[model samples]
Target: MNSKKLLLYSSVFAIQGLSNAVIPILPELAGEGSTSPAVSSLLYSGYFIGALLTLLPFGILADRIGNLKVVSLGITLTLISGIFISISDNLWVLGISRFVEGLGCGAFFPAAYSMIADWKDSHQSLGEFNFLLNAGLAAGVFFSGMLAELEIKTAINIFTLLAFLSFIFLLRETRGQTPDNSGRKKDEYGTSKRVKPPGEPHENRTGFKPGMYLEKTRETFFENGFWKLWGISVVLYGATGVLNSNYADYSAGFLTKPELGFAISASYLAAMLSSLAAGKTKAKNKSIIRAGIVLAAAGILFSLKVPLLAFFLIGAGGGAAVLGLVAAVSRVSSSGIAMGLFNTGIYAGLGLIPVFGSLFIGPLGYESVFLGSGLVLLTTLFVKFE
Candidate 1:
């Protein structure tokens, strides 16, 4: 409901955009430095690992400290990491910088989402908010790819500058919204209002016990069907990551390198378009989830043909499918923990499964990875909706 919150959300989303922009270009950059594909893939994987580790803690911290502080800290880290990467000549140093960057970027989503959850009026509007987030990311990735063609280092330079700008804007914009209990005032009823600090022990007056995060956890899991929906989301996100991390590499062998870049850009364009549409769609959760799964499965299946046109179509389909999934996930939960868990599964799947895929892919080939990821999605398709 707050314009300032929305603006801050936009900045957090732009961080995602900047990260996505750099992802597709990593392979080429690694190749330029004579790093192997596996090592190059690690550049991406390391960031996810960093993200996976930090998501929960960051979410908890955001709930306690306030989203703006956490987000500002994260952006500072991102900017520093980018500067580190810009100067590094060795792959290992670059990888370390990326891992640290991921920790910062990883926290941004849940922190920002938590803020949005705290601010928004209707719960359903999260789908639209997420659409905006994804749009920022889509545009970020698109620009990253477009910028990389000029020089990968230069692209990083631009992103680093953007990060600084974001930090400044966020500092100015969120000045009054800090979650620190010290600055807040209480109402006349002695209710001790103003959303209690996330880490503080609320008195028994609130009808919930202290030291019972586990109780809320249990309620969300078994009682609320959180696990069922979360399981499906994990699989979908993993599959999407597989597509994202590899699209440029696979297509490069067929198309000119620049065309491969264009294809990757096109995939994000598809995502950007779909996210925009998702912002407008009135579809129910059931229909959207089903459609997303089907589209994703179909995209993976179509990608097996290995034709240039098929690649483009599959990317577009997968993008649309994921847009649907984002809409679906945003509908279910508002907590940063929920967002963090959802993201953890997705990134974990993306980060870890590829290890297995790499092993089998060498023997069974690229098509197997596509089929296998699709089969995983197909299994999820039959899962009973929560």
Candidate 2:
């Protein structure tokens, strides 16, 4: 693990940890006698909203300015927003801060993926990255629960400190350095490697034009079966999102906070393990995706009765599905724009789907949402993907 890689991975861990740290304490944040479920759900979704807005633009900027540069900016924003969330009690302030924090994540992921995709063993590298990503989510969930009794903000403060440190380290590491592909070297076979030149359009061309970014983004969407992967991402992540956004409140009826946290953490832990495993598997991406859909659908359908088991299945399946999807997209176009759009599908599912599901909780109850999500996942199995 070189310092650069370590910094990148640790930063990801910190950001993800920060993102989920608030989950266990949502009730506390909502204030006593606040009856609206929408507040809690909106606060939860705010981060994703911010990420959704920024993912694509930041990705394009990463290609032009450099991935590390974008990552550094992300960390800074994360640190700042984490601090704001820790001190504020106003719902609007917290909501805005959460959005800003999500923007930080939106900046980090596409840039990070672009950098990782350029590595010699991109599949394995992406697997490791996803592993750490879930580990961070798990740790955040667990620790937030553990700390909630002591102080609702403790976990946030701790993770914010991590973001601060990561930002400082990144600044020092990148001081006086400019990001480019100029340092790329030939492989062991002595053949000159082909590295995507910095600032190049998604078409892999040398020169850029005024409207090339939009043109290439449109082309990338229609090329190499990318839309299929994007569709899969939305459905797969949407199922998990429904669970993630509602499960904490739903389980409050039966489980203690710590137990609830553990259950949620279990899902992330499963995902972490599955992602690591998926990286090493030789299975085709399509096959892996299909299998993941099955597992995830089962998880969602049975979530209310077997909360822990269901969550575990969801995490495991989601990890594998994401690994396959990301790997597939990377194969088609490793450009920042392509990675950005791919992640947009992810945030769309995570942020928007849950809010949509919440609308039906009054009339249909949580079970209907879960069942509908499951059915939706199953339906995707029949969709043709080239």
Segments of candidate 1 deviating more than 4 angstroms: 1-10, 32-35, 120-132, 171-211, 275-284, 304-336
- Each prediction's total of clashing residue pairs, residues at least 3 apart in sequence or on different chains, is 2, 0
Candidate 2 C-alpha RMSD relative to the actual structure: 4.2
TM-score on alpha carbons, each prediction: 0.78, 0.87
Tally clashes: model 2. 0
How close is each model in CA RMSD to the real structure?
A: 5.0, 4.2
Candidate 1 displacement at residue 385 in angstroms: 2.5
**What is the C-alpha lDDT profile of model 1 across 131-181, one tens digit per residue?**
566566655555665666577666567767777777777666655443435
Write down the lDDT of every candidate, Cα atoms only: 0.62, 0.80
lDDT of 2 by residue, 1-386 (tens): 65557767889999999999988887677665534455666778889989999998888777666666788888889999999998999988998999999999988887887777666667677768877888889989999888777887888999999888888777766763543465522122111124544433334336646497789889999997899889888888877887777777777788777887888899898887787788789999888888888989999987979978998998888888888888789889976678788988999888887778777777887788889989998988886775
* Candidate 1 whole-model C-alpha lDDT, 0 to 1: 0.62
